[model samples]
Every structure is written in C-alpha cells, then in structure tokens.
Target: MAYYTSNAEHPIDIVNIASLENRVKARMDRGAFGYIREGAEDEWTLRENTRAFNDLRIAPRVLQGIDHVDLSTSIFGIDLKTPIIEAPSAAHGLAHVKGEVDTAIGAAKAGTLFAMSTYGSTPVEEAAAAAPEAPQFFQLYMSKDDGFNEFLIKKAVKAGVKAIIMTVDSTLGGYREEDIVSHFQFPLPMPNLAAYSASDGVGKGISEIYAAAKQDFVPSDIAKVKDMSGLPVFVKGIQSPEDAIVAIQAGADGIWVSNHGGRQLDGGPASISVLPAIAKAVNHQVPVIFDSGVRRGQHVFKALASGADLVAIGRPVIYGLNLGGAEGVKSVFDHLNMELSITMQLAGTKTIEEIKKTTLL
Candidate 1:
C-alpha cells in the first residue's frame, strides 16, 4: 500500500499538519499517532479539545485600511520578529539525525526563539552553540533523581540558556495506545542519566538529591531551580485557570499552555481554546503562550485573539525535518511566515499589536 498520495500541486502539500499526520499514520506502525489511550477510555476530553475551537466564532472588523505591517513582539524580555516559537520535542534525531541542532538553526535563521528539549539527542550546550545568537530556552524534565535534575538545570544555565521551562504535566508518561500496541520505544536513551547521577557538586544548595527524587524526577517546587539560578522561569503543560494562577504565583515568568500536542492525556481542552481563560487568569502578570493543533497562520491569529502572546509549532516542523532535514525545517517556517504576512494583510492589521479580537472572523 502507498504511504501517501499527493495532489498535482505537490507531494507534501496538504491542507494542514493533521492531514499529514493521518497520511503518516497509514504507513507507520500503530504506535506512531493518535490518542495514546486505548479503547473507549477517552471519549470526553480528547473530543472536547477540538470541539471547543469550533464553538468559538471569530468576530472580525472591516474597512480598517490596513498597510505597513509590523510583526514584532517581546516575550520574557526577548524580542522576536515573529510570535512563533519552536515547541520542544524529544529526539529530533528520530525525525532526522541533526535532531535539535537543525531545529535551533532553523528557528534562529527565521529570527524566532527555540525551546530545546531535555530528551533531545543533541546536548543543550551543543544545540545552543549551533545558534549562539538565537534566543534559547531549556526545557527541563524532572528526573527520577533529584541530583540529576539540579545538575541538568545548572548545566543549562551555564550553557547560556536564557530561560527555564518546567514541564509539569508529564509526571508519568502518557497512555499512548499506539506505542503500547506497536511497542514503539523512544529511540534515544537518556545519555545524561549516568553523568547526572555522578555529579553531586552541581545544584547542591537547591535541594537535597533524595528529596528531589521523591517527586518522580519532577521538581517538588519551581523555586528550587529559580532560587538556584535566578533565570526567568516558565511553566509548561498548563491547562486550567486555577493552574495558570498557581503558576504565576509560583513566580513563573510565562505559562506555556499545551496538551502535549494531544499526545499526553489523550483528551483535554485544545491548547488554543483554553488560552483565553488562562490568559485572563494570568491577567498580564506574565505571557501566556500556546501549542497543540496549530497548523496555519489563521491558527496563530486565532491563538492571539484568544489571548496567546506567542504560539509554537510542534509536529509540522517534525514532519518537515523527516522529509528534508535542516532545509525542510527552514522551509516550514518560511511557509508559515509568508502565510502569516498574508493573513495579517487580509485582516486589515499591520503589526502584531494591531491583531485585535476584531481582526478575527
């Protein structure tokens, strides 16, 4: 059977990433795609996430005479030419051998920020070196070892990482039924595990290693890293208004609202749909960013209208990497940028700030 069928326009050209996801699903092992959960276990939350967006109708304004567009924004004191940021994912090497290095370079060349995953095959320092001029944030995974967590944080900070993003939603791995059926395992093992266990000198004062392990590799508190490094901190995997408020109270500089691209927790509110409530809860105390189910410029626009200060792309870039490596990743960003510029022009908005709720329809 054919893995994919393409239109005359192009082989990769499809309506959106979701379509591409479906195409890939047909050829790949069952463990590769869809809600990780099995059976009828996920009926409500998974469906609700996508359905929430449908319930919202964009309210647009006409006759604004838009021209001279400016697409610039600042998040966590870092200026970005565009509001798009690359969402962190594990082992870009699975997508391509270049892994996070390709992603870092692509985001930097496109004049945006890149988030480096702790699970990436490329080391944080190496990824940072690839795009020394680009703004980079290190994503932290609380390890089963507290000492290891501290070591990773200190290493990231020493590597010139500007911000720390704590992924709190993944206390345990998601129930990916696809992986379960196919026995799909993460291609890259934790190479840093032994190094982290041996390094006791780092992150010493932050917390006792024994205390840290109790939380199952997730930090018991964000203050441990914040107080130790004094870098701006962001909390990812946020979904509810209460959690948003809690994150801000915990000294989060930003809240990255994501449902792990619907990979974890098979059913939940779509990241974009809950952005408004989360933003409202934060009340501008910090930036609220989004991920999951975003594929086009309009999706970015919708996110902004719904209160996302910035939006991130996850799977599309991965697909691009799978198809063409570094150049492919760059092409994905370029395509999105062009689409965004056109969307802004049509909405009668000239700049990022001009994209108000009225621009949506």
Candidate 2:
C-alpha cells in the first residue's frame, strides 16, 4: 500500500483534511503550532467558521448521469485547473524550512493560484521565480510609509504577480491569546520587510512589526493600489454589502469575502454566513472570492453555491507544507480536488458552472 508520510521513521499516514492539524501538532513546537491553529480571542468566530458550514446542506440532484466532472475555472482571464486556490498567510517559514518557495512550487505543480502575503518569509521575486508559470497574486499590507508601499508594490509587479489582494481586515495584529500566552515571535527573517526596512525583524514581535502598517484605509486606496501596481486590485476583508458596493465603485476588480480567517474579530459572523449578501451586493459586477474555515470539499461546494467564483485555503496548505514541503502542499490541493470531483459527480454537476448553480438546503 502506498501512503504519504512526512517522516518515514515515524510513518504518519495521510488522512482527511481535518486530521492534518493533530498530526502536525504532534511534531511542531508549541508557539509555531499555536500561531497556525489558534485564532482570535475566545476563538468563537474561529470555531464558528467551520461549524456554520453545517447549517447549509448540499441538496444533490441524483441520477443526472454525469460521468466526468470538470473543475477548471478562470479568474481575471487566467485559467486554473481547480476553483480552490491558496490564501495568503504570513510567515510560512514558521511551518516549513523552505517557506513560501515550497508553497509557490506546489501550487504551480497543482495548476492553481497561490496568493503570497506581504509578510511572507520568502521575497516576492524568489517565490515568483520558484514557479514561473504559476498564477500568483500578492497580498499587500499597505505600510504607513508611502515610499515603502510604492516600492513594494512596484517590486511585486516587476516579479510578475497577476493581481494585488489588498487585505483590509487587519490593520493591526489580533488579540490572539495563544501568541500572547506563548510569547510567540517570528523565529526567521521576513525578507519582504527586510528588503525595505533593512531589518529582518531580529528582535521585534509581530505586533511591533504591524505597527508600521497604515491604520486608516479610505475607498480611494483601492484605486491607488491599482495605479501603483498597474495590476488588477481585489479588496480583501470585505464583510458587508455596503463595503462590497463601495469597493466596486472605487474600481476594485474583485471583492474577497473573508473575516481574516477568524483571526481578526472573534464575535464576527463566519465568512460563509456573510458571503451571500456581499456576493449579491456585488451582483456579478466583479468576482467574489471567499476564504475562512474551509476544510472539506463540501465547504468549497457550498461557498461556490452561495456565490464565490473561487475559494482559498490558508491553514490546510500550511499543514501540508509542515508535513511534506512542496510535495505536501501539492498533495493537499490534489486531495481537495479529488474530493470536489466526487462531490460534483454525486451531486449531478458536471462543470464548475453547474456547481455555481447548485442549491444548498
């Protein structure tokens, strides 16, 4: 029997997506594991992100005679093999030795997209170079300094990122009890920050680093980012209909529906719960991208049914990266694609278009 295992001596067998955490926990250190696992204060929204998916039931239409399922979809004129894409999560070096370089390689191998965070352990060019053919996006945390923001955006554009995903939810670090208790600080260099600051965050903590981010974000910032990068800009962290409309009106190419993976606000509604209204508000004027608490293929299906052109995974990719590096990240995407193919066939949907039309009970 062929099985996937990070360590041959330990022989940790590959299992379902939900099982990756506990398996990773057994091997990773306390602070590093906590950073990936724990969310905001009380973790109510964190837990609810997954729990709320149970509210929507998949009303599969049986016996439609669908044999082959097509998972291909296009975003911003770029084609992808699966609707599932990698979400931007900072500091992949905390999880794997290779960091986002491995992530970019894996996503490219899987024929999907990987959004690289501004705080990524690897520099934009190195990550983009890791998988030259891959469709990658840069997630920007606009710095308080205008020069730094313009410099970083131009650097990413030079590296060939297809779009800019401006994360609006996190102007500051969240009150993550786990990090506070564990006294967690990034152990490795954040070259992205170092490129401009001339410091690899030798002794500073994440909160201290976040202090340099721009606190006030106006709607015009959307157009500003686009003009800065000369690439399509997607306003991430949108949770309301009003915000969605504001973004589109401000020339946003897409509206990314996320609650910062439940890492920003503990009591806020789950990303899935708020997705419908935001999607309706955007009203297909721009693409709606979604993330947060997505573990199963059904969650991906439900999100598309609710009105998402694409769904991104954050923690799961890290889990895979921790366990198996580039191959592991590819495995994570491969498994989800397989599960989604099964869901499509069982639900009588043959294409991504059909899955979007699926009704959840």
Every model's TM-score: 0.83, 0.96
After superposition, candidate 1 runs with Cα above 4 Å error: 1-15, 22-51, 197-220, 356-361
Q: Residue 49 of model 1: what lDDT?
A: 50
Best model per lDDT: 2
- Clashing pairs in model 2, backbone N/Cα/C closer than 3 A: none
lDDT tens digits, residue span 205-267, model 2? 868888999989999999899989989999999999999999999999999999988999889
User: What's the lDDT for all of these models?
Assistant: 0.69, 0.89
The worst-scoring run of ten residues by lDDT in candidate 2 lies at: 1-10
Candidate 1 local Cα displacement, residue 73, angstroms:
1.5
Error of 1 at 330 (Å): 1.7
Q: Model 1, range 1-361, lDDT digits (tens) per residue?
A: 2222111111234444545555445533343233222222354454455556666554544687876567788886788988888988766655556777777887787789988877666778889999999999988877665566788888888889999988888765555454445555443433444355553222222123223433443333777768766798889999999988877777778899988777667656677777878888888788877887777777777788788888898877777665555566666777777777877777777777766444344
